[model samples]
Target: MKILVVFVVMVLFCDCVMTKECTNTPTQLSSHTYRYALLNSKNKTLKQEVLTLSSHDHDHLTPTDDSAWASLLPRKVLKQEDEFSWMMMYRQMKNNNGGSGKVRDSGSFLNEVFLGDVRLDSDSIHGQAQQTNLEYLMLLDGDNLVWSFRKTAGLPTPGVAYGGWESPNQELRGHFVGHYLSATAMMWASTGNDTLKKKMTAVVSALGECQEKMGTGYLSAFPSEFFDRFEAVQPVWAPYYTIHKIMAGLVDQYVFAGNDQALKMVTQMADYFYKRVQNVITKYTIERHWRSLNEETGGMNDVMYRLYTITGNANHLLLAHLFDKPCFLGLLAIKADELSGFHANTHIPIVVGAQRRYEVTGDPLYKEIGTFFMETVNSSHS
Candidate 1:
């Protein structure tokens, strides 16, 4: 009888695991489905809720007055802004005319000005660029681009070597590669340098190959197990911090150098990231592991938001929302100065993410939160 009971218990356990695996699969939304969902009744209700919340007189209202809140209803449609670009410049031209001093012309009030190739054809700028390019070339090796990825995957390190700040012993071993990619891509764009463009392409290709070898859409100098350690509140360096840099670098390459491969790799990595985090972390779990976030995670939220804007992928938008640190942001929302002993660099990225969220979603709460945080930081920390 005891042996029979044991067999039944094992069978039940296996069945439970299988059921969970089946349920964990993410729903794949077709483009048409995504658009339909965006325009559906559910989204309209959400928009109404956002508007009501934004216009609510929170100071005068009591928490128990649900009827009062419901009576406020909703009004106004939100406007969407264009994706931010550094090259796009805008300045408000003051009108000195006698007629009410208000600029009537669309070109007079605020206008976009094109600054044509400021980085090119200037001797001083070219000299500085040449010096920086020389230093970058000295610091990096085209062949060793895959060294860290190889090491993480338990494979052999190939040709040349990573040294200086990106040496294997360094805590930030994988960070410089991302920074290098961004710098090279921007330099190529500014000066139309074929050599720089070629180098950027090679590095991106090598990284893509590394990602393929990992076989899980995961690419990093360290394994995904680091995130497990992070969730467990065990001692580990900032894995997401490193990941943000890599994602940002790839995005820069795609945007500036027009490298499609970089975009593909980043989207793949983002999918893997979303699945892992959604499966592992929940609001309750994140609250429980709040102390783990004391370490820097960089601007994971900011980059994810940018990715969403680029691809219009709901998954990326969801990922961005998930990275919000409620403990910090909650305080900021209430205009509390809770940043007394916080790491300035670590928290600043989160505030910037809030600002980006405001721009993308047109949510006034995010704008308020971001503005409050920025004001507090400028007044206190600055």
Candidate 2:
């Protein structure tokens, strides 16, 4: 009896070890470092440039303020990527607005504080963020942000926004606003601020209600039937793209907001995909109609990897690979450089998944190919 008991204990120990190996928790380097690196690399913010990105008039813009916009990013990534994106935006804004150093400075300040490089002047900071309308994406100003959340909450308001973005402004308000949710939430949690955190929490709650109302554990700014249509291959708007926005937003909420509900929300959506996608053949056929319309299924992998991140489910990861669709997989598997004419944003997130695949599976080739794709896209497309 003693021998048998000892053997059982040994087996349990081995199983525990193997389970740990399979879990997708960051075992070594932080999962967040690369993102901050990208932000810094975005605009060329020097690592040593720690100047306070503030003006005398900016800090008091809002009364009784509290938020973390200062420390959400991973330490290695905080300085560089945050600045780089600002540099990129500054260049673009310069081209459009003409000689607005202050505009670029505001972007720089926001990124710096967001990643924890400096404290923002609460009073002037809001004005600065609002003044640079294109970049800051202040969620507080318009009825649109609240309405967007309410619409997704199923409040039956005609003016209710959907997709958590002002649906009327896809390019300006949709995916980009999601990035703000993520960044803002991250900033708040890392720094212990309740305002931004509360704001994001409300949005998350509204979206949760929407998911509940749909009664299928799925939520989005778009209609629920979008997935069915995608499976049916019927004509529809970019369902996968919209899914990416929500997926990324949810994942961001988990990462930035530290909300257990956010994690559950993401997992439920993944479970929904796992439950629904396999036998649905018609979606592909419906998708083919886009050859005439020029609107192809873009941003599929973004959602898949987001699912993979939350559930660490092999099915979610495999589904992302499945999204290689008829167009890219065969060629991408072979490392084709001929992928030039594709929409830049649509495909880059796919490569991001390939990179994640490499991370979890220890597949070096996925890393190589994903890096190559990123290099080509950043250099040529942007």
Per candidate, the number of residue pairs that clash is: 0, 37
Identify the leading candidate in terms of TM-score.
1
The list of candidate 1 runs beyond 4 A from truth reads: 1-117, 125-139, 154-156, 282-291
In candidate 1, what residue range of length 10 has the lowest lDDT sum? 86-95
What overall lDDT goes with each candidate model?
0.61, 0.47
lDDT of 2 by residue, 1-382 (tens): 6544543453354342211001111111111122223223323342122111111101111101111212222346447656455344324422432221111122222233334344445468763663353234334532445454446546664344444224543322344445555666656654456666776787677667767777777766555665565454343445566566666777778765677787787778777765665545244432332221122334555566555655656777656655543233323433445554444444556566665555444444455667777666677656
- lDDT agreement of model 1 with the native: 0.61
lDDT string, candidate 1, 1-382, tens digits: 6544543453354332211001122111111122223223244554344224322211222112333222222212111232111012111001122112121233323443322244544567776776677467645676686587678867777775577545565445677788887777767766676766777798888888888888888888777887887665443456787888899999889888889999999999999988877665564453334444544578888898888778878788778876765556655654566665455556779889877776666555667889898788789867
Residue-level error in angstroms, candidate 2, position 47 = 51
Looking at candidate 1, what is the lDDT of residue 354?
Answer: 77
Top-lDDT structure, candidate number: 1
Return the TM-score for candidate 2, rounded to 2 decimals.
0.55
Distance (Å) between predicted and true CA of 181, model 1?
1.4
Candidate 2 segments whose C-alpha is farther than 4 A from its true place: 1-143, 146-165, 168-177, 189-192, 281-303, 306-310, 375-382
